[model samples]
Target: MPPLPAIEQPAAVFVARPGTAGRLGQAVSWRQLMVWPRWVTLAGFAIVVGAVWAVVLGVIAGAVLGVFCIVVSTGTALIRRGLTARRIMRGSLTVATPGMGMASRFGSGALDIAQANGITRLFYDRVRGIHVDRDIVVLRYAQLFIGFPRELFPDWAIELIRAHRAASGTTGYSANIPALPPIPPIEQPDVSMVADPGTAVAMARESFRVTLRSVAILSAIFAVLCLFLGRLLSHDHGLAAGLGLAVITTVWLLASAVRGGPKTRAAYQLSMPPGEPLSARFGSEAFEVRTASARIRHPYAAMTSMRAHGPAMVVRSGGIHVYPRELFPENAITHAGMVNKLLAK
Candidate 1:
C-alpha cells in the first residue's frame, strides 16, 4: 500500500492545490445534481398544469402541457450545467478531513471533502457501492454519485476510502487497500442551547409571517386572474367574483398558518425546554442534537444550506435546525467556518 503524505494537523488529512480545478480533485456538476430533484418539480408542474388544463380546455391539451412541462425543465437543466461548471472551475482548493464518520478504534471511516461550492462529508457506512478508475472514482450513495478525480486526488486517500468501503460491508474495486490510521482527536461543544418557551413560538411566528407574505402575493395574482375569468365565463360582477375569492383566500391563509405555525412551534418548544437543553454535538461526519423528545442526526453530506439568521445558526438538511448564537460558541467555531465545513446549497 502507498503511504499517505505528511499531515499538517491531525484534524485535516488531505488538501489539494489552490487556484485551479485540476487541483480541486472532486466536483458535483449541475447535471448530476439535477437528475432526481428535477424530476420532482417536473412531475409536480406536469400534474398541476395538466389537471388544470384538462378541466378548462380538454384532455389532449392537458397531455400536451404535461409534455411541455418536462421539455422546459429539461432545457433549464442543460442550461444550468454550463453555469454550474463555470462556478465549480473557479474553486480554490479541496480539503479532506477526519473525525466525521463512523467512529472506530482505528479511525472514523468518513471523508470530509471541501469542493468548489462547500464541504461534503461522506460516511463509509452510507456508501452502497464504489466505482474506481485510473482518472476518477465515484461513490454511489443516497440516489446520487459523488465523483473524485484521481489525477488530483491522492493515492493514499483513494486507498483509505477503498479500505473503509470494504470494511463497511461494501465491495471495492481496489485489490490492495491500505490500513487506516488511528482516529484523531475530535472537538465537540460542551455548551448546550437552552430553549426558552417564548423563543420557539416567536421563531415560528416569524416563519409564518414570511410564508404569508409570499403566499398572499401569489394568491392575489391568481385571484385577479380568477376575477377576470369569472366576468367572461359566468357573467358575474367583478366585485362579487373578487369577494368570493377573498373568502377562499382567507380559508387558505388560515389552513397554511395552522399547518406549520402552531404545531411546529409546539414541537420545537417541547423538544428543547429549559430543563432539557438541546445539546447540538458536532462530529466529523454528522451533526447531532439530543433533545428531550428525540435524538436527531444530520450527516454532513446531506446538508443543503446553512446561514446565520439573526442570533441563530440556521441549518437545512431535509429539515431545519436553528441554534442560538448566544449559546453556541462564537469564537471557537465561527459562522464562516461552519458554512465552509458542510455542503451548502
Candidate 2:
C-alpha cells in the first residue's frame, strides 16, 4: 500500500444524515415526526390569530406583539443562516441539506409533517482532533457539538434547521467541494486472522433466502385474503376486485424490491471473504465506498469521529459522512466484529 496524503488545516465540521457506510459500516437511526412543537407553534399561531380574537386594547396589542415576535424570530433565523453559509464558503465545514447526508444525520427513519419544521445544523471544530477538510453541512444534529452548550435536537427540528440552512444556502453548500480523503492505514490489534469467504457467502445467502421466503409467504397470504374475501360478495364488483388485487400485487412487488436491495447486494458479494471481516472496494468511476471493516481498505482520511449508530456506522470525512446501513445486510455486526478482530492483528 502507498502512503496516504496528509490532511490540511483549518477545516470546518458539521453533522449530516449518514449517506454511506461509516466506521465499521454502521449507521445511526433518527426519526422525524411532523407534529413536533416547532411546527405546532407555527400552526397554532395561525389558528390563534383567526379564531380567538378580542377587542380590548391589551388583547389586540398582545396579539400584534406576538405576531411581531414570530416574524422577528424567523427573520433572525434567516440572518443566522446567512452567517452559516459564509462559514461554508470560507471552507469551514461541509453542510448537507435535505436529501443529502448520512441516513441518521437528521431524520433517520421517518420524516412526517412536524419534523419538517425543526431540523438544524451542528458544528464541530474538529472530529477526533482531525481537522475537517471542507464546508459540508449535515441534515442532522450538525450543531450538537458546538456553541457554549451541546444541544441534542429532535429529528423534526433537525429537518427544519436543514430547511433554514438551504433557504439561506448555508446548508448543503461545500467550499471547493473538498476532495475525498485518502484511506487511513489499518491499525491491527493482537488477534488471530482468517478470512472465510465461504462462510460469509453462506450467511448472506441464507439471509436472503429467509427474506425471500417471508416476502413470498406474506404476498400469498395477502393475495388470498384479497381474492377470497371479495369472492364472498355476490355483487358484480369483479372488475373492482381484480383491479384491487392488481394494485396490491404492484405495491407488494415494489416494497419487496426495495426491501431486497441490500440483501441482493450482500448475496452478490458473498463470494468475497466473509466470516473474518473483509475489505473490498465498490463503486463506479463516480465515487468510492467507506467503512470501518478491517478486511476493507478504509483509506479515506476521516475528519470527524467514528459514531457507531446502532446497526449503522458513521464516518464524517470532509463535506460528507458515510452510512453503511443502507447498503449492507443486518448481519453486518458479525462481519464488523470479524473485521475488527483481524485489524487488531
Candidate 1 per-residue lDDT over residues 216-329, each given as its tens digit: 785776567545544543443434543454456556556756665655565556545565565655545555554554444455555666565565566665335665555445
User: How high is the lDDT of residue 275 in model 2?
Assistant: 41
lDDT of each: 0.49, 0.33
- Give the top-scoring candidate (TM-score): 1
| TM-score: model 2 vs. ground truth | 0.27
Q: After superposition, how far is residue 310 of candidate 2 from its true place, in Å?
A: 26
- lDDT, candidate 1, residue 182? 23
Global local distance difference test of model 2: 0.33
**Tens digits of lDDT, candidate 2, 53-108:** 22222354335434543564466445645544443322221223323222113222
